[model samples]
Target: MTGMKAFFGTFIKEIKLLTRDPAGLILLFLMPSAFIISLSLALEGTFMTVEKSVNKYKIAVVNNNTGHDGKNIIDLFEKSGKLIVLTNFEKTLLSEERARRAIIDSDIIAAVIIPQLDKNRDRRAEIKLIIDPGLANEVGSFLQYSLQQYIYISEIARLNIEKNMLQKSIYPQTVEYKANLGTIASNSGDFSIKKYYALREATTDIIPTSVQQNVPGWTIFALFWIAQILGINILGEITDGSFRRVKVSPTSERIWLTGKIVPYFLINLLQVLFLFALGVYLMPKIGLPALEIHNTGALVILTLAVSLCAISLGVLFAALSRSSFMLSSFSAMILLLMSVLGGIMVPKFVMPPVMQDFSMWVPHGWAIDGYMNVLVKQSGIRDILPAVYRLLIFSLLFFSAGYLALKSKLGRI
Candidate 1:
């Protein structure tokens, strides 16, 4: 009978509608879990976190050195325990071609070839790295840098040994490390990506593994997928002229929009919490490290901002798209594109510099970055405020735009 009563009735109806949608429930719950497990396993050897030292990224090594230098280099990688060296697979020693193929086949992260050293040079063997092009850039760089550090340290030790034997030697500048990445086309693509994902990873005290990135990153992605569901629902109501019927009532537009938003907003929060639960509890059951959060407050506020942003964006889309086909197709395309660019399918560290800059423009990137700060970086409430602020700004803008869009659409502007 009253506006408040009408708003509550509409909210309760919307909540019922959301809960009954089997398709939406499956997409929000089942699909993300599948992606988390599949992707984490696929990239397992490519991404290793500092917290878990027992497991290492797998790399094949081929030693061609005439003397013990090659053996010593292999020893270094093995001793580090961060890289699992596979000198032989199936009882045969790894050759350069076999190693390269191994990387191409996605069996290993990289292939290391230790060339024979020049006896007169008194230097260590030239270590060549053959990386997988499909490998995340941050991942490729981590392996490259790790190998270089090991060889660099070994060289320093070798130089010291020589200096004592000869009683004197000048330390020449260390040779720059070069990595040759195999590409999809030639299978020998020289990956020359200049920017390292390490720049971002270095800010966090703990290195993020594939699982850590997925728990939060994919959760943000599935959260945004809510936009499509909300947009479609609103579009359905509009097509049936249900909105015009409601608009004739005494209830204000705020009540109408709020009714549409609150139900889906709550659903989105549950989606995030559910995914995070899997990360913390179910992930370890599969042998992956359990997702740990440093600040629950940061996560809670961030989730609130993120869900608000997504629902508002959905409202904006539903208002703008006049037809079912237009709403569904465009919103799905846009969400998928944003997900790829937003570090959902790939980590921000995996993307190049220009794309990373572009990611800042979207709320998905902000949400993903915020969640990563909380989960991986062990960042506190203060640390995630900027991200929370950005997401809130996005929600404000989207809601304003959607309001204007709806007003114009009803009046044929």
Candidate 2:
């Protein structure tokens, strides 16, 4: 009973002392708020805006086909609102060397060379596409995909026209003698309706669902890493003799540690809640669907586990180091490296196979994976249990290691 009271007294005193210093208070509260607000606003604009309008590519088209059909196809490409066709390329401009130089100079994204159309040969038109490798990969892929879709649609339209013409021709009617003299309509002999049907079905949705699903996970991962920066303030106090003085009191060290970390854990929880609210409320305004928060309880539990893991790591590092400056530098480096490896900086899907294998060992990776399971996948507790268990195990491991290291250091000091 006495110990509990003493601990509470000490905890209250510590909070009071912390708040008395304007700089300390600002470091603890104002700085984190500012960072969170600034980062959240900045990222909201960068990632959430779905209707990204990209400029039409400057494409030089060399059409060797004098046929009206080939010219009509080129006209269709131009009218699709995707390609800005340039036809002024003479022999010198059409040379491969010149095209390569033009791409290097950023004069054009691609060049389309159409082979001469011969009616005697197969009707398939040969089109050669040249794209700049230096351009952004997404931009290049988008251009290529758009061009391919346009070509497919044009071909389907031509096929449909020819099919309609064939259907209009009357065939000789064959009559069979029947008792009732009823004429049966002959079955259209296996008309190739499959291709046109498939095209119609496939062309409905062009934008992928994965892009919308992945961006929120990236935002959550980044915010957690940035908020974990608050742990450095604990190390700052330990270096300046504040923690040592507090330890000399009758209060239990465990309770004191709890008091110090509770605020940070709460801060992390607030961040998670804010992210959830933003994803649910604001994202839909920008064309993204509201993420289902059906597993809010599980998300809270997982986030606390991750926050504890991070805070324990910070404490462990602070206790092991003798200098506050060294702690700050080392902790920042370690966290940033972990964040990068954990897919906070880059999506895990695009990572190399070896890196994907390595990420499983990182604690932050597990944390990010857990959040993604719940928020992006709309998964329940069962789906995320593996990642949650990993985070809990990491938290315990880091807590034990940190406690032992702190105890040993305090014994010497």
Clashes in candidate 2: how many?
0
Model 1: lowest-lDDT 10 consecutive positions: 182-191
For candidate 1, the TM-score is 0.63
Report, for every candidate in turn, its global Cα lDDT versus the true structure: 0.72, 0.55
Clashes of 1: 1
In model 2, what lDDT does residue 358 have?
Answer: 69
True-vs-predicted CA distance for residue 197, candidate 2, Å: 26
Clashing residue pairs, backbone N/CA/C < 3 A, model 1: 183-189
Deviating ranges (above 4 Å) for candidate 1: 49-206, 411-413
> For residues 77-173, what per-residue lDDT tens digits would candidate 1 score against the true structure?
7887677889997799899887766654446667778766454754433567776433444556776776656555545555545455454333244
Q: Identify the leading candidate in terms of lDDT.
A: 1
lDDT score of residue 23 within candidate 2: 82
**TM-score (C-alpha) between model 2 and the true structure:** 0.53
Relative to the true structure, candidate 1 has a C-alpha RMSD (angstroms) of 14.6
State the weakest 10-residue window (summed lDDT) of model 2: 194-203
